[model samples]
Target chain A: MNFVHTMETFVEGKKKILLILLAVFLIALPYMLNSQYLVTVAVKIGSYTLLALGLNVLTGYTGLVSLGHAGFVAIGAYTSSLCAVKLGMNFFASMILGMVVAGLAGVLLGLPTMRVTGTYLSIITLGFGEIIKMIAMNWSSVTNGTLGVKNIPRPSIFGYDLTIANNGLYYLMLVLVLITTLFCIAVVKSKTGRAFQAIRADELASTMMGINITSYKILSFVISACICALGGALYASLIGYIDPNTFNFDVSTLILSIVILGGMGTIRGMFVGAAILIAFPEVSRFLMEYRFVLYGVILVLMMRFRPQGIMGWKSTMPYRLSKNVKEQVEKMDKNAPLNLLNETKG
Target chain B: MAEKEVLLKVDNITKRFGGIVAVDHVSCTVRKGEVVSIIGPNGAGKTTVFNMLTGVYEVDEGEIIFNGNPIHNKDPKEIVAAGISRTFQNIRLFSDLRVIENVLIGAHIKTKYNFFQSVFRTKKFREEEDKKTAEAIQLLKSIGLDYRRDDYASNLPYGEQRKLEITRAIATGAQLILLDEPAAGMNPQESAELMEFINKLKDQGYTILMIEHDMSVVMNVSDRIYVIDHGKPIAEGLPEEIANNPKVIEAYLGGVQNDAEDQ
Candidate 1:
């Protein structure tokens, strides 16, 4: 425990430097690899990371497991794709539109399922994912029937088209991932985040704390859906083609697996999880179909042993005290009764 | 002293669960700056009364007036906004969060910032967050749990967890605090300390409504005691009067001679 504590402090102290180095590495990754396939894989990881991070808010922080997150992704991809194709809309504008639509869908889903919890909620989400796919498959005029929205114009900024070969898409993914991470960090650190964790810890206790569990739960769903839709918008553009099959139950399972494998409720875990899970099958093609079997075994073993996931270990460092709070503590120490002062010193 | 202003008036509230009436027409009034206790034997609907008051359960009938407004049947969040907060009998601290975070969550209702402000880290968000954090830390200090503020709430010992729960309730800016069995599983020494701690709160002018099984703490700390049995109010009076009330004794010890005669 002592050794672990020291190690954690060491990591905490050098955190900023480490983060800078990581940022530098991610920026130079495509150049260093010089492989389009590798860049594509990196982009995939980025997309999955965004999805997992979004799902983390609901499942990890708020304790609401959603299996139909892919539905939000589908909504984003289709809405953005359809807008770009039929209306000749700009990529960013359409993407925002897609996100808004998905958020509305989240509100719709959250309201009806507010009274349900645990496995029941998961089932509803699972059905939602299927329903979305069914709509995409059957809704011919808008979705173009399973042939899918093809020839999706690549996203561009300042007249430069983003493609996997040019690494524009990769950088765009990186920026979105960073923004989502920052958003997640901000949400987790604030009063809203505390309420989310409180609800997850104990619904009864959270309600007693005057937290409007209904509104907060709905808010969580909205945030999660928006993030997932962002990822979906990115995916549709990256692949330059999107079909109903692209966002199936399997994709939802993969995103959830990334969350569970990376460590739920930790932002850093999503990056690691997405990197390993997305890159694993590519590198381990030698294992053939057996790679999937290995994947199941690994997840099961993780559950049996480190159920908290790789990065889910609770930090040993003291909870961060804000600058103002630190000053207050100092003032309090000075003004404390003599006996209390003596007790604190001792 | 002049008659104390009533902070809470629970008038003839009834709650029924199917065929069972959990709390039957229970009525009580809590005055400002007083430590009022509801004492009852096990399964006497003490917790049900607490749940109804806190809006965890809607009253089947009657009303709960708080600060001269009928607050019964309102959402728990609105009820808390009206200045009532409570701790659980089972000590429902947010185990995963740090101690200070748990207390900060109690101050959630008091935070004025919106979701956008929190997301954007706006000036208002920062100011309110820093203020609440400092206040929470100060509260922890008062309870001597400041050093453990960074620790996960579940890591605290049982007594400290109970103290933390009360501190969390107090942080909610509540004018009236409800404690559901605050001394359920404490040793004599711990109960004594709790009695002192409750007295300290009363001295701070916070009205307290508690359901306590520990007679010593209840008798010593409460300005008045209300006794119940089988979901029915048996007696209400000063602690000394309650200790002498034949009906209170009968409710607690179960009418010994009457049972003997029946046998």
Candidate 2:
């Protein structure tokens, strides 16, 4: 027992050192890259990371697959921009408005939670995204139609304008992304987060455990949509333009792919996955046209080799029973453990 | 026993699943602190009755009264919140979660922290969390699973998984716990332990409703026994009286022959 305690502390110490090194790296990256294009790419990665983190809560933690997240993003971007342009709201208030609108859209879309899941749920979300896109395309009076909303003013904080080229914009996004990341981490460790995982683990069992299935399922969708909306509002501000085409099905698929590839239900994995996928096409322009093909191949290989993804708990940790229980498990027939685990997981 | 107050009253509740009656006019009463066993052959709809009691399946006829209040057509979660919880015939644990986490999920009803409080980790959240953890550990200790609290519930041996499911059910602060065929796959030794555990729960003042095929367990642990066949109660009496009842014997003999032919 004493030896195990010491070993745990050793591992804890190593993790702390590693975290400090990671913090140094993240703080230095933008300043180290002298090129403006590189910094912009970094900004895009930061925003996409935020987006993937949101999807992670729904898909990774709650096990609710959505194929229409871009609809929420579109809602966020347009709502924020329109609030500023038409309603004369400040940038900060517009962003909050965007989150609220997207959150409501999320709850609205979540109405099918009681009736569907897995592929059916995915299809429903996909249809919702396409419908949102059509509305954005046709609603010329408010959205300005397919021509897109142009010249979105940059966010101003305390009389300081965070323009496109300014480091202030990058720092602002970085801070918001960090906040979102921390907020998600907090959620995943809380009782509510455990309820989400419980529901994901088994909805029937969760309901039996006194978790309201409808409320928790909708809560997951609302939180995911709100986070995605925040990211969209930031993306619109960073790029200074918005279009219905920008928040398309392809973008939604990319975000979902990032979650799966990086490691579903893993915080650190989301950042790594988003950074790699977002930076890949930028560095290798020649392979840009075949990016979708590359993603497909990678996904197939991953499914074949590591269905749990890069940082999944099952991949990183060995299957283990308690020391006393291990003896009991060993005495059981060869296939009992696998069958029990599979039957319970199902 | 004569002075005991009735805690749960199942008033002729009937449940039909698409043209077939699963639980037909099943009426049973549980006193405040007693171990009641419901025994039947396969397809006797013992589990269906448990499902209705826990609100998993809505009663199609009549009403369920718990603590003198009508509880039919209520949601399953709400039923649990109202002091009833259950385990499945086949264990339905949150496989990926740690054992302690499973019990913590059961404690959801007692904890008062909301989403914002949890996210911000307010003082109330911390206090409730600490209190819940302590309570869960105590529950696990009673079931002899405290040492394995950190392990995934799926990793426990089959019998321990069954025990954990019981521990989780009790952790919900349930006054009435419905255990369905808890000894289905247990060895004789594990079944003995489960019998002891049921007795322990009764000693702790919990009202337990169990469906058991293990006659030794049912006869030794149950204060009262209700015998059913084909969704209807055939007999209800004390364990000694149930052991001598002619109709109960006929039902068992008929089931024993069916079991022999299937084998």
Candidate 3:
């Protein structure tokens, strides 16, 4: 235990250097590998990372376990693809539209379900995912029905087409992942984030503390849906085709598995989880269909033993104070009456 | 003392759970800058009264007036926004969060920044966040828990956890604080310290309404005392009066004459 503590501190001290090295490695990954297949795999990992991070906000931070996240993803992909193909909209505009539509759907789901919680809520979300798939299969005019939307043009900025071979999609995914990660961090560190966690901790106490639990819960849903939708928009363009089958119950479970396998409520855990899960099947192709059994066994063992995930351990370092707050605390400490401090200590 | 205004007036408030009357038409008034205690034996509906006052349980009948405003049946968040906050009997701290984070959560209403501002880290967001952080630290310092600000709330000793709960209530910017069983599990020495702490809060000009099982702490710190038995207010007076009241004794010790006759 003592040695582990020392090692944790040692890693903590070199955190900045490690982060920089990791950034360089990620940026140069495609060039170093010199393989289009590896680059596509990396893009897939990035896409899943975004989805997992979105679910983490709701499930991990806000304690709202959702099993219907793929519904939002389907909404985004279909909306974006339909707009681009039918209306000839720009990629960015359609992506934003997709996110907005999915967010509205989230509000629709969040409102009536505000009063329900626990297993009941998860069941509702699971049904919601199925409802969305049914709609996609039946809504022939707009969604193209079971035939699916095809010929999704590659997203391009300034006439530079983004394709897997050219590594444009990979870079785009990287940027989105970075932005999403930062957004999650900002929300987690703010007062809004605190209220979400407070509700997770104790709902009655959170209400007494003047947190509007209903509004916060709804806000959490909107944010999670938006991020997931953004990933779906990218996924449609990357694959150049999307169908209801692409976002079935299995996809939702896959996204949820990444969150659980990496660590719930953690940002970095999403990356590690997505990498391992997305790469595992490819590496174990020789095992064929039996690999899925191994996957199920691994998850069961994970639940039995390290349920918090590989990176879910709470930090041992002191809580980080922002710069201005630290300065103010020091100033207050200097001006505090010595006798008063001593009295409290006694 | 005669001119002291009523900070809270709970009048004829009754709560029913199915066939049971949890709190029956109970009423009490707390004056400004006073430490008022509600004392009762076990299952006397003390916590139910607290829950009703804090809006955790809606009153089946009657009114709760805070500073001349009718507040009963309002949402708990609105009640807190009207400047009332409370500690829980079981000490509900955000155990996974740091101590200061728990306090910051208490200040959630006062944070004032919108979701977009927080996401973008706007000037208003930064200013409000820094101000709240510094204020939370100062509150911890006042209670001598400044050094433990970075520690998870669950890591604190029981006594300190109790103190942190009160501090979190104050961080809500509440003028009237409700403490539910603030000294429930404290030892004699800890209760004595809590007595002093309640007195200190009184000196700081905050109105406190507390339900305490520790008679010593209640009797020592309360400016006035209200006693109830079986969900009804049986007596209310000065602590000395309550101590000497025959009805109060009967309620506590349970009919001495009846016991003698049975013997």
Candidate 4:
């Protein structure tokens, strides 16, 4: 057991160094790009990473497919924006409130998971996203309907405004992404994370093992919603405006696809998936025009070739190999029996 | 002979799926510290009985009293909380997790950390997690799986996977453990080792009720055996009694003949 601990941490230590380097690169990305347009793209990747990180916890780790994450993001954006505009609240505090509101909605959405799963779950979530969009469209007094919310205030620390003009918002987004990534890794290492994986592996076995699937399922949804809500709040503040159209079914699908492309149930995969998904279209005007077709093709190819995504394959961890390899190889030979019979006949 | 207190009582439970009655008015009891076996042919309602005991299926008609509480129709999690744990007949393990993680999940009911504590990794959380990890490792060592603790559960060979499932059940700290089929796919040597492990569990004062098709394991490990056919118990007695009972023999042979005719 002690040796196991040492070996496990040795592997974990390598991951830690890699994570630190990644964080450093993200923080310095704005300086490296030296262009506001690319910096904005990096910021978009950061927000997408946050969204994919949360969805990974729900869809990847818990194995509950949700197609309404953008609904939660909409709830977050509206809630935070309204809180700041109508009530004159702090930007950061309003974002927290947004997370809470969206989290409650997640609980309401997760209740159906007690009875429905898989494709049915996906359908329910799709309905939830549409319902949210409808509310955003009709609730004119609060949301201003399709006209949308504008001039959303950016967050500030010690009176320093974090806006795109100052390149501070990009840094803020990067830091949030870093925090979210760490939070996800922490969760995947905890007991609750283990229970979620257990449920994903075998729900009946997980229940028999004393895991309350209902509560864990709800908890996963709540955490996932909160993270998405935070991303939504940041998006509103970053763009200085948001409308119901931005938070649509396509956005949810995009977030989910990011989780899938990055690798389900892995933290690093979020970054890889988000970068490619966010950057690919921006780099190619033709891809941007045929984005839907490209998405369909990528998904079809992924399903056919690598359903586990880029980083989902199991790594070669250190384990003791069987010592009788030569003997096993001999036994595996199809002609070994024939040779033995021939010798006996001779 | 002194009579042992009943640890579990399942009385007249029936389960129906649409128009078919899977289990009908089945009744059985497992006494404390006893190794009891429920043997039946395929589709004899053995697994259904186990499912009802563990609260996997809501009983259509019956009462399951465990430690003096009527636990019939309780939520599976609540049933587990009341100190009952089970393994599936098909060896359902958390394949995505490491072997130790499967066992740690079994200790979920025993852990003290909540969501907040887990997220924060506070002092109390760390202490409790360390304690549970130590306990889980100890359980793996006892079950002879410590060597493969870090390997994914799915990576294990079939026999070891069965052993891991049982080990996970044991990790739950249940007073009464129900095994659906502990020796279904094992070779003779593995089955014999499993019989030894079951005996060791009995010596440790754990009450065990099992649903098994392996007659060798059923006859050797069970202090008492109950034979069920067509959703009802046909006979119940000592292993010797069950082995020689005319009704039990007829039911088994009749079941085989029915299977052949259906084929």
lDDT of 2 by residue, A169-249 (tens): 778778888899889987987788888999999888888888988888999999999999998998888888899999999
lDDT of candidate 2 at residue B157, scale 0 to 100: 94
Q: Which stretches of candidate 2 lie over 4 Å from their true place?
A: A1-11, A86-88, A288-292, A314-346, B255-263
The models' CA-based lDDT, in order, is 0.89, 0.84, 0.88, 0.84
TM-score (chain B) of candidate 4: 0.94
lDDT of 1 by residue, B1-263 (tens): 89999999999999999999889989999999899999989999999999899888999999999999999999999999898999998889999889988988988887778999999999999988887787777777877788888999999998899999998998888889999999989988888889988988887678999999988898899999998888888899999999878777777777775653442
**Residue-pair clashes per candidate:** 0, 0, 0, 0
i-RMS for every candidate (Å) is 5.8, 10.6, 5.1, 15.3
Q: For model 4, how does the per-residue alpha-carbon lDDT over B40-157 read when each residue is reduced to its tens digit? A: 8889988888888888889999799999999999988888888788888888998877887888898888887787787787888777776666656656665567778778888999
- Candidate 2 chain B: worst 10 consecutive residues by lDDT? B254-263
lDDT of 3 by residue, A1-346 (tens): 4664686799889999988999999899999989998898889889999999999999989998999999999999999999999999989999999999999998988885568988898998999899999999999988999999999998989888899888899999999999999999999999989988998898888989999888999999999999999999999998889989999999999999999999988887898999989999888889999999998898899888989987777777777778998887776763343123113221
lDDT (Cα) of model 4: 0.84
Superposed model 3: Cα runs more than 4 Å off: A1-8, A333-346, B257-263
Which candidate comes out best when scored by DockQ? 3
Best by lDDT: 1
Task: Give every collision pair in model 1.
Answer: none
lDDT of 2: 0.84
Worst 10 residues of 1 chain B by lDDT: B254-263
Which parts of model 1 are misplaced by more than 4 Å?
Answer: A1-4, A333-346, B257-263
* C-alpha DockQ for predicted model 4: 0.23
